[model samples]
Target: MPSDTEQRTRAAVPADAVTEPLTDIIDPDNFTPRLLALLSNALVWRESHELRRRFGLGTNDWRIISSLAIRPGASATEVSDFIGLNKAVISKGVVKLVDRGLVLLVDGPRGSRPMYLTPAGAEMHDAMLPISMRGQEIILADLSADDIDRLNALLRRMLEKTRELHVLENGSDVGADD
Candidate 1:
């Protein structure tokens, strides 16, 4: 089932949508939605990778930091479930974060341990924020202000639909890495 926004933003065959003939022989003139998505993701990942190299942060460490920045006091398992990563990977990141003084692990009821970003972690995330924003700015530089807004609207709808599909496929809001 699609949301109202998703239902409204069908990808119509517009003149502007197809900039050039796709090299792919299949899929009707080689227009692959995935190619666009992957290229966009790769661009973002490059920024993230550079941030990690500069800050000495691993991918999992960065993910955990960003996740905790958004939803503090979440357990490693919860973080894993939230990010669809293996619990072991989350646990490793948490341990490293704790050792680096970027995060703190607190014992909770029923033997559950919750995590929070330390002040240092918060600062690190704040510092790295500009890199992510710059990545977006560079990626969308060709689009005008109005086109940017329209792109955001369409992307948001697509994201919502994908989330719904993820939930339906997994049968839960939390995806299991296993």
Candidate 2:
């Protein structure tokens, strides 16, 4: 006999609740991975379009800028690690930012070049902050504060699990080279 907790959990989702055939993989309605991918892709597409239309910036550009805004004087490698982006991509974005006069690369200790936002960069960050916040607000409008907190905690746990699985499968953590 199943325990009460187990019985309740099983009862929460009836066996017949899933309308699609069990063999149908990649069902967005039933597969969490597919749903998550769809959500991420939609969000990225919308954000990229809006940012490019309003500020002539791409999502990666905004990500780099925002990362710098939070961690000023961070090196390209550090920024790449923090943002989970490819080092080459981050380096290219850094060069573009520097050429646009929005970022400054200063020589740091041990030959590492640290990046900082210029005055114009800070101004642009401030201008773009609202759009970013609004996008978050729109997406999370249905979730309560507690729900949002719990959702973030769950996502963090999933990220940690992903790293662990990567290490187990590949003998190295994800983005270890980056």
Compare the candidates by TM-score and give the number of the best one: 2
In model 2, where do residues sit more than 4 Å from their true spots? 1-24
| Tens digits of lDDT, candidate 2, 1-178 | 9999988887897786874577835656888988888877887788888888998888888889999999999999888888889999998988888998889999899999999999999998998788778778877999999999999999999999998998899998777675
Least lDDT summed over 10 consecutive residues: which range in candidate 1?
A: 7-16
What are the runs in model 1 whose C-alpha is more than 4 Å off? 1-30, 81-84, 167-170
Quote the positional error of residue 55 for candidate 2 in Å: 1.6
Taking every candidate in turn, the Cα RMSD to the unseen true structure, in Å, is 13.7, 11.8
Tens-digit lDDT track for model 1 on 73-164?
99988888777678888888888889999999999999998899999999988987777678678868899999999999998898678778
Top candidate (lDDT): 2
Residue 27 shift from truth in candidate 2, angstroms = 2.5
The TM-scores, one per candidate, come to 0.68, 0.82
Which pairs clash (backbone N, Cα, C closer than 3 Å) in model 2?
Answer: none
